[model samples]
Target: MDITIHRPGELTEPLRRAWHRAMDESPEYANPFLAPEFAIGIGRHRAGARVAILREEGEPVGFFPYERDALGVGRAIGLGLSDCQALVHRPGVTWDAQELLRACRLSIFEFDHLVEEQRPFAEHVTGLFASPVIDVKPGDGGYPEWLRGSYPGLAKTTLKKERRLGRDVGEVRFVFDERDPRMLRTLMRWKSAQYRRTGRMDRFARPWIVDVVDHLFHVREEHFTGVLSVLYAGDRPVAAHFGPRSSAVLAAWFTAYDPELRYYSPGLMMHLRTAEAAGRNGVTLVDLGRGDKEYKDWLKTRELRVGEGFAARPHPVAAGYRLWRRPVRGLRNTVLAHPRLRDPADRLLKTVGTLRTSHRADSDGAASGRR
Candidate 1:
């Protein structure tokens, strides 16, 4: 296949349409991140993002949205800690993946979450990873029935709690596509606080994350859309889920609940509502994006393999860096590999968070009531 490189800003309507068509044609392609809107959104916000447009017989066949960084490093645009893969295209089209690197002038391409389907360039790959998902379709009666058949204990427990909570709170309601921006802000705030408490970096700290959220908020479509579902206890939002919804797949992306209301399990309730709505909307699957959460297994019927390994063009500069980076990566992996070390490492991070909070409090007290 003959592939041409194009600057992110230079993408045309035909190119975008072809890219979407290629992705739409692929059965394995269900990610919103692989969509043109997502790539364009990232390109508009992130610097140095470029699109590699592949062609055969003067017709577009594939598209990849990548960000060129210092040291000739390239990665999927907006792929920081995200579970989706890069280099999205139709099947049966083969090209020298290295040619793409040469076209883009990239040295090393790092992909922590690259898809396995694009393994033609596996020689240049770095690592392998698994992204877990749940198939929330069983044709019986949507989530409620699926849960009863799959996880009867959990279903019974959750329904019992739901009944108790509803009795206490007056009425429990689920709102989908809530038009208010305030609900999204509340979910972000809760998620941010959860990250801090759990010693994970707040993703919203990055400007692109904020822009992506705001962009998805306005992007509503049948197959590609952002659905914000909120569980309300007597009109007060208790839990909210911000995820991508499609005709057949509703991906569980981001979720959060009020800490004080954790006892009611509002998050689970919101998820239940989402699954029901997805079935009602002709959705065949609700993908709870890659993780080992017990709830996922309880709510899902099967798992799909998603993500890929990194590939790159052979450049001496990039080769040298990869060589040196290998040992460091190995050491880090080894450390994380040990369950003993991993647990302590996590604890240490949590301790550091507590200390940071204390120091911040002291500084704030010193500056308070001062102008």
Candidate 2:
């Protein structure tokens, strides 16, 4: 087996085509996050991005995308934002984890959403998580028929809300693939505000993340495409979702709604509408990601197991990195795994968020008065 490392941008056309073939041949690797285009997109914005190509008999068989710092500390490309992570490879392709790390010049490789079929890294896994997914199948009669047949209880209530929303706000409508850029900006603003209210890190506050999303929105490819879905009521955007889609799978990424219309359950409506449209568009699965949200419980047809851990070579940097990072992840997992701990943590975070939002508003008001 031969291993070579290169910047994602340096990948030749043949290599890119081989990568696409690898994705198409494996059901598990069909996720857009694992696609070469996604890696290239990240590489375009992040200076540390690199890909390790594993070859045999002069043919590329595997691709591993990651980010490395000067200290040889590494992470899966787009770790926090990407729902699926893997060393996308053809069947019967395997490599020594240690050898791969050495070839990439990494002391430790950290990942949170590692795919389950990655046997080479299995021994290094620290935890297994249930990632919810919706299996999409378009009914012969369309969305209403499909929803009624699949989720009768949910359909009744959600449909009622849809009707009410239309009567109160104008006409409730959905666009599965909205091409408007202004609506994308609206999604970012809603998502950013949602993060602040939930005391989560505002991803859009970072310029690079914003740039990446904007760049991806325009990407049109056979293997990967950015899909923006919007749900509107009387010409007003009620909710929106922006996620990446491979040929078969749509990853449920960033989703947000008008908070003032929370009573209308626009967020849930967005997910349902998106799923229906995705099925019609030939998407076979919707990966809702690895989280224990109530909405995920309601939407998922089944669950897939993902992993989180560090694959490391025997080095001081590797040891130190593990020592520093493992405990933080452990603490978070513990809180999330148990509602007893999670509820209080959530309440505390919300309290902090309320305080933070109020302070910002007060500051803004003071500035306005001064002006």
TM per candidate = 0.89, 0.99
Which stretches in model 1 have alpha-carbon errors above 4 Å?
A: 138-146, 306-308, 323-339, 369-371
Positional deviation of 160 in candidate 2, in angstroms? 0.4
Error of 2 at 135 (Å): 0.6
Candidate 2 structure, TM-score to reference:
0.99
Compared with the true structure, all predictions reach lDDT values of: 0.73, 0.95
- List model 2 lDDT by residue over 1-371, tens digit each: 89999999999999999999999999999999999889999999999999999999999999999999999999999989899999999998878998899999999999999999999999999999999999998888967788898788799999899999999998988999999999999999999999999888899999999999998899989899999999999799999999999999999999999999999899999999999999999999999999899989999999999999999999999999999999999999999999999999999888888899999999999999999
- By summed lDDT, the worst window of 10 consecutive residues in model 1 runs over 129-138
Top-scoring candidate (lDDT):
2
How do the residues 1-371 of candidate 1 rate in per-residue lDDT, one tens digit apiece? 67677666678877767776776788566677677767666777777778888778888888878888777887777776355666767778877777788877788776656666776667756555445554554447655576677567778888788788779875777787787889999999998877777778989877778877878878875447878888888878889998776556677888999988799888778777777666666777776765555577666667766543456566787777667667776776666667788778878888877777678788898889574
Query: Can you tell me which runs of candidate 2 are displaced by over 4 Å?
Result: none
Best by TM-score: 2
